[model samples]
Target chain A: MAYSPAVQELMEALRCLPGVGPKSAQRMTFSLLQHDRSAAGRLARALQTAADSVGECRLCRNLTEADLCPLCASGRRDPGLLCVVENPSDVQALEDATDYGGLYFVLKGRLSPLDGIGPGELGLESLEARLAAGEVGEIILAVSPTVEGEATAQYIAGMAADAGVDIARIAHGVPLGGDLDYVDAGTLSHAFAGRARYR
Target chain B: MAYSPAVQELMEALRCLPGVGPKSAQRMTFSLLQHDRSAAGRLARALQTAADSVGECRLCRNLTEADLCPLCASGRRDPGLLCVVENPSDVQALEDATDYGGLYFVLKGRLSPLDGIGPGELGLESLEARLAAGEVGEIILAVSPTVEGEATAQYIAGMAADAGVDIARIAHGVPLGGDLDYVDAGTLSHAFAGRARYR
Candidate 1:
């Protein structure tokens, strides 16, 4: 009663995606069998095409099919104001906000000392080189406010300080619509430290 | 700033998978830039291979990589008892149970007149032809107990009756662990109709 080897292998391969588990894998495998064979074909093709063709932009470290990512290649963007993020996904999220018009530097990972992931592993040497180019006037640290994220930001801040670049971290405090009572202790403390002066 | 044409096209293509939206497509596309390029390549190859190689089994109509599916070709199974199901995945589920040693016939669909699906669309004639071959003895109707499923079973039953083959529909009653109090009206009525003789 075991499934054919091919089907089982396909299910296993599909389980690699984030949030996909055994049950979801089974459901997806079954769906591929039931309908939309073309979509399944698309998934397979996308996986291979992205792998083969897509690479990081040498300037911005964002994903691109060419040597430079679109954000970096576009002459319209402000290269002088670079935002540093832990992952490329963060770049997309920031884009959805529609507030920034600057270049980006993706770490592709965070500084996890316990997991043996250090600054060198996250392409810090390239950041130093970018800083030394003297074209960047300001750097906005857009890493998340989590412990690992904070550590990485502090590390980058120290590096930027030595490079004589103006360093600014993204705000970490109360959310716009969040109730004061519901705010967590760490966030409340940050809110207090980052309180804006009233006229 | 607008994404480069390559980045934008690949992102849109990645969104074709089930549950993958524009946001996820972007994230996945971005991650592909960081993780092994070969994984994406493998996914694309798997898609094409599955699409091009996998097709319906000639005998049972279940999905297969060969002319005859693994189940049909296996020498260990009983060819005389065929379990008729509505989809290839159902065959997989039944196989997973590892109890039934019989053959299978996948209908690919049920009789849904509302949705323009009918017996002719599900290869009822091919099923009759298989029965006329006189190799099958007991034909088990393993369809779900929904209205459409019941109607399909009835239609197949009439055909089997004309062919002089012994037809048996799987019994429908209260689910094994279901509570009588919470059972729906339709299920309650079906349970009454399919009741067994009390000792």
Candidate 2:
């Protein structure tokens, strides 16, 4: 017998995960069947649990199980410093550096008009509101170094300037076109520490 | 605020998918938030749907949505020719070739004594029964060239020898220490076409 339709369907579904193509999906599906039925079940359950339970933090747009993310709720974090990023993964990269005690503001996307993503789509209104509230003293732009990322940073910097907030952007230690996820934690941390003020 | 707890949990859960490390998982989680609320929901549904519906074929241990996989039920496939493989992925690889017209027997796993996998665990009894019934005239060994895979193929050959069935094994066009999943489809098809008889 060849692969069952159910198994094929499962393999196709597994391919939806990032970096998992058709072949890898098939290998993973069979491996799960051969060795760890429980792990496969857990993975399915986790996908559902995550999709159903997770939502953007009301404040920073970071992933969270609760209504308020830990960074937002925690009094110990430096609430005065706000680190703006393009995606949640960037936040993880920044946290790994352990240099910044500040909370994060995830843009969730960059300003790509061609792809139909604009400031409103990226929740810039919420960012503006957060800056107006005066709860944040320093704003650090920690987005990627891509052209779209640079454009988004410039747009946000202009907004921050109008708002009269102490605005800064992360240092450019990472190469152009590099993903924050691919950079080493040490270099990322150093970049965070040596951030320069945005002009 | 940093990512919310719910988002964090979802990202963590997504990491279980094949090749989805911590960084990619986080990126996917955030990227999904950008526009795929419905796609995410559909993905969650598909994961559970496939897991619950798929099971091993009773005949070959291949993945199936029904009692038997499509290849087993299809009258067009040559039941007289049985191709034995270590995993269901191998079946897909062969199917993609569109050259062979034989039925398949999926061992679902290889023999690894260290891992406590033996012949009985591989369902050799059913294979022997298929051959003894005289329904199968040719048995093609499509197992991999790895140490465990070779051992499993040799064991199958011995079993086929006792049954007095014509036997052939896939040749080693695959690079040593290379995975079949990584090989190109054309190479795999060529390898399949040029398979030699294993004594």
Candidate 3:
């Protein structure tokens, strides 16, 4: 038998989540209905609020409720050092792990020609405008190490060159605490080529 | 740095779901904000609608927008055969796998003394009322194989005996397609003890 219209709607809506499938959506729907009505209400209000209010920061393209994201607006960050990444989550990851006092520019996606994502789709003209303002002296490419990420980094590096800003890609190597024997051959060779000299 | 108030609230609300922790909540919040604003809005409206409208069925205590659940209200089901299950999901599972044209009564929980769950909390009084109406001739206990489930099954069996109705517990044995070696000793012993005569 089919679920009630409201339950079916809730289950269908839950399928919009990143990893949730039909079975998980069904389970989540029943779970919310059976228990935690107050929490369910709060979740509803939160979803509405976030959906209606959250938008991209005009300067960095990171998610924010204001014209400029907190990172871009903060005076403590170094305006001359700009880090470019693929998504807003990447900004959070960098903030959590590093003490870098620099601003960030979120691309919101990588260059995927098959999916129709390109330079213009990523709002690169706005990024070019920011770089042309002459405040950012160094542009750090902190995108992923995938092939698309590499191509996107290269394209951004060319843009940085045109803007006369020093560009650097984040280092990729065997992760810390990862065994050299377990590392892939391509990564091992890359790490060897970029090896540092002993102090 | 802290997330914006809207994002933070969404994350906190997502944490209310079962099995969702802080990290998953954060990821879900960002995913909804970045990839699917329309879906997020739909989920919000669904949550509010479901929470506001859905209520327990008056006859069987299963979730329903109407006074009676579909199973109870349907004329095709056998009113003489009643299946007692611990949760509404169990009813769905039975309907999916078995062609038992019987109606169902959802307990919403089992007998867990440590958690203060008892007969009253499980709405056994309503179950007894249904039994007393004399339409039900056989009762099938479909609770889980946990200790609490066992106690609940036995309690229901005693009630059925007092009401002069036939009662049967669903069989517990090795699951279909499971390797014998992989089956636990308790299940193995139960299967051995309940062996049937060859036809």
Tens digit per residue, CA lDDT, model 1, A1-199: 4455566677776666666687777677767656778778766765666676776788877777788887788788888899999877778778888689888998888899999999888889899999999999899999988889989998999889989999998888999999999999999998999999898
Docking class of 3: medium
Model 3 Cα lDDT, one tens digit per residue, B1-199:
7366788789889988777887888889888998789999999999999999999889888888888877888889999999999888888889999999989988999999899999999999989988999999999999999999999999999899999999998899999999999999999999999998999
- In angstroms, what RMSD does candidate 2 have relative to the true structure? 6.8
lDDT of 2 by residue, B1-199 (tens): 3455456666776665567787787767766655566566666665666667777777777877688788887889888899998877778788887589988998978999999988889898899888888888889998877789989989888888888889998666767887999998876887789777899
Best by DockQ: 3
Kindly report which residue stretches of model 3 are placed more than 4 angstroms away from their true locations once superposed.
none
Give the Å shift of residue A24 in candidate 2.
1.6
Which portions of model 1 show Cα errors greater than 4 Å? B1-7, B30-33
- Residue A163 lDDT, candidate 2, scale 0-100: 82
Candidate 2 vs candidate 3, DockQ winner = 3
Judging by TM-score against the true structure, name the best candidate.
3
Q: How badly does each model clash, as a count of residue pairs?
A: 5, 13, 0
Q: In model 1, what lDDT does residue A35 have? A: 78
Tens-place lDDT per residue, model 2, A1-199, is 3556566666776655556787787777776665666666665665566667777678888777677778778878898899999877777777876689988888878999999999998999999998888888889998887789989999999888878888987667766788999999876887888777999
Worst 10 residues of 1 chain B by lDDT: B31-40
**What's the TM-score of chain B for every model shown?**
0.88, 0.83, 0.95
Worst 10 residues of 2 chain B by lDDT: B1-10
Tens digit of lDDT per residue, candidate 1, span B1-199?
Answer: 4465566766777665667788777766666556646556655665666677777778888777778888888878898898999977778777787588989999988999999998888888888999999888889999988889989999989988888889887777788899999999988898998788899
